[model samples]
Target chain A: MDIDTLDLIDQYLRGNLSDTEKEAFEKRIAIEEDLQEEVLIHQQLLAIHEQEKISLTNTSYQQELVQMNEILNEEDNAKLSQKIRAIGKNQQPHTTVRFKRKKTVNWFYSAAASIVVLISLFFIFNTPKALPDYYQNYVNWEELPSFTVKGDPEELFEKGEVFFKNKEYKNAVATLSIIEPEDKWYPFALLYLGASYDQLNENEAAIATFQKLASLTTSEEYSKGYWYQLLLYLKTNQKEKALEMKTKILENPNHYKYKEATELDF
Target chain B: MENTERYIQALIQGEDQIIQEIYKKIYPKVLAFILYNKGNEDDALDVFHDALMYIIITQKEKRSVILSFEAYLFVICKNIWKKNLKNKVIQTDVLTLEEKETNLSAFILEQQCFEFYIAKFSLLSENCKDILSSYFNGLSYEEITLANAYATVNTVRQRVFKCRSKLIELIKNDKEFQKIIKWGA
Candidate 1:
């Protein structure tokens, strides 16, 4: 095939051709089997290229998760270290003074008994439901109704919604953050932005976003900010703050998540 | 229904919480299966990760319309472990007869196609790879030119066309590609 024909196919696939040219190309594709096959081949190649991009994006995300996991593991190690130090402090004087052979036997039995109690307590308290369980139970963001807007903002909003719906929380946060303040969907975008941050475990950013939304807008227009903030606190085990938000929600039964909030307990 | 879709979407998007949930919910069963089939904990984790990657790539390729994400994942993990253990004398009673003959072949074919494409992509020049990567990522000609200082808008367009043509030619001429297509038929 000529380079011009290849160029036309490229332009057509990219939706870059003018209306008349696109019509002519479509007419030619109908009659020319080879051209049709070439178009199909071009489309297949494009899909392969797209797959490569997605793979690359996924690799980056995997790296980010690895780093995040390392950070979490370090935090866990630090906490474990602190707990060990506390245990050592509790036993330091006792170990120093109880060096007698007769006391050593009693100390061994007491230590064994203490270990048994610690193990029992660990099993008992470790059964507390996890944060993810609470998230899955309470955080249900329904699919928003589809509507049309006229300009570039419409495209931006749609892209954000696509990321949000696909559960691409990081991508959703990035995309939704670009919505202009004057856009009709700005407030809604902020809400979803907070939701995205919450999903990403960026609780501080999520709380800041919700706080901004709550302070900037009236309760009737942005009650979801409070609702989501309440759930965010609950998911992170901040029951006191969550209860405060819950009381606020209950004070006004007209809030959107009032029923769900009422059903929740510390 | 929504949960299954959410799981698939989460894997594709690489969401942290949902991924952790998947590990919590599904990894234990996969680990148990692998242990029962003469594999260790590390091997089980590796197999599970590979299976998850394969499922994500297959989904991206639009190869399978998943019915049940959990069941599909478990099946894939089991098949992978069995394939690893095929050289050993082991009871193969874990898989249902229907699953044995049907999806396994298709899955293998898809894997072959994916590997072939990756190999072919690796053969392209660095410049072509850069331009084509940007193009496939939905960058406009003007944006591509702006991002890559050496290229003009027109040059970017021409380069993209040439690079894609070369890629298609390479893929078409690949011996494994022919075999894969024939087998997929």
Candidate 2:
């Protein structure tokens, strides 16, 4: 801690000490605990100083940034900026805000007649209801883990997955159904099976598969079955059943699709 | 990683195809982060541009291999935006291109100080760091000795005192330390 000790430590660090002096200092350092501590501090501080010196003097990195920016910002590189801007725009939340039109034309008979016609049309058109485009809006199929088939030496599930992804629902169903029901992949097979049926407009088969899957309470995929069943019921114009399913989901706040169910307009 | 190197190489070479792919894939993440942190699309674009340039230039100068390109790029963009948000001049909705450049350079200078500390600290001896960490974790000298398996309690006490004084001395004499003090004030 004293100046002489500090000076000795500094000399040792800089290799300024003669061989005899350095040897003597090491011997003393072994017995003198304070010397070891001082030596370590001096060595560390010097290392820090050397690092800082290098960093402060290295100005090329900063210049490179400016140069690279100029290159990227060149007029011809406008396409790059446009691509980035498009990406930014695409990432914005897609919330379609529908504005209800005010009924300014208030002639009583016409309004009443229009209301009745609208009600009748609503009932007629609401059955299929375009299925709410859940495939586009909710199903991020690529993000889902692929079904790993046990003893699938032929990679049948891989073919099914590719078929499903490519909109070949019939092929997906046929390939997926080849896996036996007792196989570990049966549950996942059922998922794509139901989805493929849904895609193919075979609502009864989709509903049946989803119903069976829903009953498998211990499987992690149980929630998907309940959800798809609710969706299929809606698609099949079974409003009462869909409502019951929604209520069942809402009964437990922990339901996977509880939030989506709560937000369902129908 | 190969993916990291590919991105870095793309930046260095200014390959338009790979760079466009980078923009399409990674820019969304930067945009989301910026939006979550109270920045608009323009602010996010500015930060992303600067961060990309920073990476490109850093690769050309240092050629250091980043462990994760996406994560590293996000951190750089985060730092730049944070500094931008804190700048008094940024209260104005619009900045001229020259003003933007000046502001960015100021951020880079500020960030260099942080980089200096991280680089230096990472180079410290593990034993020295452990002693300092133990003391800060509120371990007594006897506890530290027991934890570190030192020969005696006195050795721990000596190491603790040594580390503390060394830390103080390093901080006091650090070039960035003075800049940080001024900036805080």
RMSD (Cα, Å) of model 1: 23.3
What is candidate 2's lDDT per residue for A56-146, written digit by digit as tens? Answer: 2224545644654565556644454455445445434332111122122223234223321111111222333344443334443343345
True contacts kept of 1: 0.07
Q: Which candidate is the best by DockQ?
A: 2
TM-score of 2: 0.42
lDDT of 1 by residue, B21-80 (tens): 666556645654554455655556555665665565456555445677778788778766
lDDT of 1 at B65: 51
Superposition error at A98 for model 1 (Å): 48
Q: Write the per-residue lDDT of candidate 2 for residues B37-63, one digit (tens) a residue.
A: 566667777888778766754566567
Best-fitting candidate, measured by TM-score? 2
